[model samples]
Target: MSLEIVDSCVGCFACEPLCPNKAISAVMQPGEPLFFINPDKCTECLGDHDLPQCAEICPIEGAIVDEYGEALNPLGSLTGIPLHLLEQMREAECRQ
Candidate 1:
């Protein structure tokens, strides 16, 4: 499974350091700034812990999700972010 931070994120930077794989990154946007988790670096904390550290620390609910765009199940979770969203974000960033 993977994770993606939605636009609802307030850029609180709360989920940044919590990522064990150091996947989360702070990006400055035009309107509202937010954090982006690098799918390549993201491991969903699977090998490190039973839960995704970023999700665990995220104060905002529904901010993270799996490849199916469903909320990540905190129960014995895996690592990485959804390939689709990750690619989208990467492409968006590149265009910026």
Candidate 2:
């Protein structure tokens, strides 16, 4: 359950650093910039928050969406790889 920023994003850059997993990045679009969430890195704030911090802090309503583009609500689309597995993978890759 990764969060995605739709085309409706106002480029407010509000969701970038707020991600605990460091999954969000800024991408420049034709007119306004957009934020991209790396699904591989996103943990949906699992093991950290009771809910997604991005959706909680976003000022623009409906700007943050779940993988299915549905409005993010509490307990919505909380799917992502387990944090421990991801960290183990990273550690193994770094050792190689």
Q: Model 1, 33-76: lDDT tens per residue? A: 78888878888898899988877777654678877887654322
- lDDT of model number 1: 0.75
- Runs in model 2 lying further than 4 Å from the true structure: 73-96
lDDT of 1 at 19: 79
In order, candidate lDDTs are: 0.75, 0.76
- Candidate 1 runs further than 4 Å off: 73-96
Backbone collision count in every prediction?
Answer: 7, 1
Query: Can you list the residue pairs that collide in candidate 2?
Result: 1-79
Write model 2 residue lDDT over 8-72, tens digit each, in one string.
67888777878999998888879888888899988889999988887877766557888888877
Candidate 2 similarity to native, TM-score: 0.67
Best model per lDDT: 2
